[model samples]
Target: MGDSNATMVTEFILVGMSNYPRAQMVMFVVFLIFYMATLFGNTLLIVLIILTPVLHTPMYFFLCNLSFLDMFYTTCSIPQLLVNCFFRRPTISYTRCLTEMYVGLFLGITECFLLAVMAYDRFAAICNPLRYNVIMSWKVCFQLAAMSWAGAFVLTLIPSQFQPTQFCGHNIINHFTCEIQALLKLACSDTRKMEMVLMINSVIDLAVPFSFILVTYGRIGQAVLRMHSAKGRGKAFSTCGSHLVVVSIFYGSAISMYLRPQGKTFSDHDKFVSLFYGVVTPMLNPLIYSLRNKDVKGAFWRLLGKKMSE
Candidate 1:
């Protein structure tokens, strides 16, 4: 909130399981493969959402934004992680760390809310089919997407505005990047406010989005059960199934990571939980929706077959 900038720290050292020698090399290769897949998988989703007119609906519109955010989200952390993991020396400056955190948090938080919006879109489409177009129109979709990004920036960027606490005790962060939790751990200040901010953010992030997703699915399940024909019910379920599955993975990891940060006797698990959303979710998103959805499959095949002939 201050016009003057906070004093920047020089660099960050990523302490990624330094005790495990051979494991560090192994992790580097594994994460490399994940990064490659994350790039291609998410890029394809963006293209599919754009190139296919059938996919120009509000659902796909939001999905393209998700892919875009996921692309940056994974990119912000993974490549730098590779340097630390493989090269054995990973350091990031304070300004760079805050920037990464800003971008990473915004993208991650935006995706969380965007998923909620997508759930609502699916909800209106299935539960109240009579006004799907009217309810989830282009204008509304654009507004929702903008709101997601804006909300994330306003909420996260505010906390990051403060100067980083001195890490004189231990300058090493155990994880890959300078995430809020890891950064806070390095802080030598009275971080009660920072912790409170994170707590409040967690509540809003989990409660609002989780509630929306659940209610959407609940209405969707209700509508599906009321179907007269088995085929009709299957059809309805199929339409929402891919999205529901995606929402589950995306939200589940996110909620699990952000919700109960204190109950754990250990914090090492944060790395794995970050992987689910930061890496797996991005890579799996296109695959999940494309492989599972019939129309998307048809579009993929049609696009592929046409490309091969050309």
Candidate 2:
């Protein structure tokens, strides 16, 4: 019976954006635009940071990592989503589904940790200006980045090892991607334990880091207020504000999706919420930083002039 069940569920039919059958083409165009923008924005930020020596601070280092992460995060599922819009009944093999779920989870968790580290970078810069360089030395920055990646891998890998390897029943995923919660709804085996594990992981990856960022920002706020120099205060607020905006958008949608009680069925609302972080946030990160940051803008013009001159 178990072997038969496993063999029966080889692929999952993705009921992605299919509810609005008439709007399929519109959804495809929209998603394709978002996907292209995410790729271009993130890749541009990464390249700009690399080519511009002036933007080589700890903040941009983390931003470059984040841009790379956002690119990968969207790539993990968006292309497939864009293609699925063209098909009447889009399907993904069970293996590919599981791979997407795990990879997305890893990237999501890494972003959680990376954002918190970026928050700390802001805290050090604003609250400890005198010690900022020493505190966020190249060695320390690399170590923090390494820890975020390694921590996410361990967090994602261990719990996933215990997840049900087989899924049965109607193999239909309502979400565009093999999201963890959506995938859990289709598990053949008892998922109470897995749900508990996921809950714990959510608290660790989402709750803890978010709380840390909040407290870090609070300290930064106080420090900025105490600064006597108007210019200093403005600079501090400008940089920290950009980071805070990114944090709010990414964490707000993620917490809404992952930290919620597991429901027996996924809804259209859930799919849209997933799109906000999975698609929108990645595209917005670079735009937010580049538009608001003078250093980035200056670097871009300088590089443009250099290239044109050559």
Candidate 3:
């Protein structure tokens, strides 16, 4: 019986942005541009971090980790999506779906925890600069980052284990890739417990980390307010502002879509919002941090200049 279940899936079709027959090409072109921007922006950030010694601080190190994650996360979904958008039949093998799910899970989980780590980094930088180095030491930062990646998969594996094949009923997934919730919705078996697990995951994913960010920022706001110099205030805001934007973008969509009750039919409006969490936020992270940040911009220019010469 178990063997029979295991053999049931040799392939699966991804029903996503490309499935729309009427305007698939237009959607493809739009996503193509977004995809290109995401790739170019994130890659540039990574190169900037590697090439610039000035960016060798705990802050940029975290940003670098974020850049790699954002890059890989999008790569897991976007190009495959681009390919399918153009192709007549956008079929994905069962093995490929599994692979995609795993990679996406790892990166998604990593980003969630990494964001929390970033909050702690901010807390250290602002609230305890004297001990920032000791607290966010090399060993500690990497450990936290590693756990984020590992933990996400650790949690994601729980769902995969119990989840019966939802694809048997409706093979077409309405969003990009086999999203966790969307995939779960396809299951034929009773999913009351599954929905509960998903809620817990979503709440933990959003609430705990966001709570940390909110608290850190609360402290940061206090610290900023005490600075009497307009110049000082500007500087403080400048640093934390990008992170604030990222937190807002990443968390807002997540809370709205995932935190609510588990619904049988997901709204198209919600699908669009999910893009901010999955696709748009990843693209924007590098841009917001790199463009606004002095060290990152300097690193970018240095790296680009060196690359051009070489």
Candidate 4:
């Protein structure tokens, strides 16, 4: 019966950030700028890594995957957001909404696992420098990346399977994007089981990976402290700094958004938090990595020099 009722609701209205006419226009322009920056910044990192042979190591290889993920992550929702902001009430088809939800889940979960994989890479580099190359070889790196992609895609399917059957015809999603939590709010049926499922997924997706990263970094910290040379310690810190910053931004926003009490009232605050992780964080990652890492800067200059000579 619920499934039958869900079919009647063919579209959903997205109640975006601002109801005010002027604010909607302002937000559209602001998000347009953010979307453009996300594209340009992530693209630059990917191209620099690809064009520069010096960046062909495991660390940059993972960074390349991250850049590609960020590219699609933002693209999955921001363009729709930009389009919706222009209208008083923007509607998304049931199929399109489901696609957006699944795509976002796929990319978000993949990033969570990818960050944990990166933390392991750093641990190998700093804690066991002698064995870093052996442990993080091309084969191993490829396997880890593949696992992150495949694992996230499969895990995302569970939540998606629960979606179409649950949205039993309240078609107004009070958020800009078709986020899992936002869409869950519109469901007319019992959400306790679904929320429990999402919560379990969140724990596995966010907490477990975060705990792994923490343990990896803890060992890395001890190794860095034991280094007698200040130069060695500084190098280790520099190597890990960009990743640490990126992780903090990514996990901080995600945990805040997802790992909360299910009974808590949803608000416009949720929308802003989603925006931070979805748009702001993606745009910031490339800047954080490029500006903080000398290796990437040098690669950029070397690439530019070659381009100039041609």
What TM-score, computed on C-alpha atoms, does each candidate reach?
Answer: 0.91, 0.97, 0.90, 0.95
> Per-residue alpha-carbon lDDT of model 1 for 1-310, expressed as tens digits?
1313333357777765564667998888888898898888878778777788888888788878888888888889888878777556567787888888778877888888988888888788878889988998888989999999899888787677564566554566766677777677776655677677877887786678889788788888888888788987876777688878888888888788777755312267786787787778888888887787787777778788989999
Cα displacement (Å) at residue 183, model 1: 1.6
TM for candidate 2 is 0.97
Worst 10 residues of 1 by lDDT: 1-10
Query: How well is each residue in 210-287 modelled by candidate 3, as lDDT tens digits?
Result: 888898899989987887789877877888898889988888887887778767865577678878877899878888
Candidate 4 colliding pairs: none
Separate clash counts for every candidate? 2, 0, 2, 0
Cα error, candidate 2, residue 136 (Å) = 0.9
Q: Over all chains combined, what TM-score does candidate 3 have?
A: 0.90
Clashes in model 3: which pairs?
A: 11-94, 166-186
Q: What is the C-alpha lDDT of each candidate?
A: 0.78, 0.91, 0.78, 0.87
- The sequence of per-residue lDDT tens digits that candidate 4 reaches over residues 30-59 is 999999999999999999999888889999
Top candidate, metric lDDT: 2
- Greater TM-score among 1 and 3 belongs to 1
- For 122-190, candidate 2 gives per-residue lDDT tens digits of 999888879999999999999999999999999998778678766766689888888888888888777
Q: After superposition, how far is residue 42 of candidate 2 from its true place, in Å?
A: 1.0
Candidate 1 regions with alpha-carbon error over 4 angstroms: 1-9, 261-266
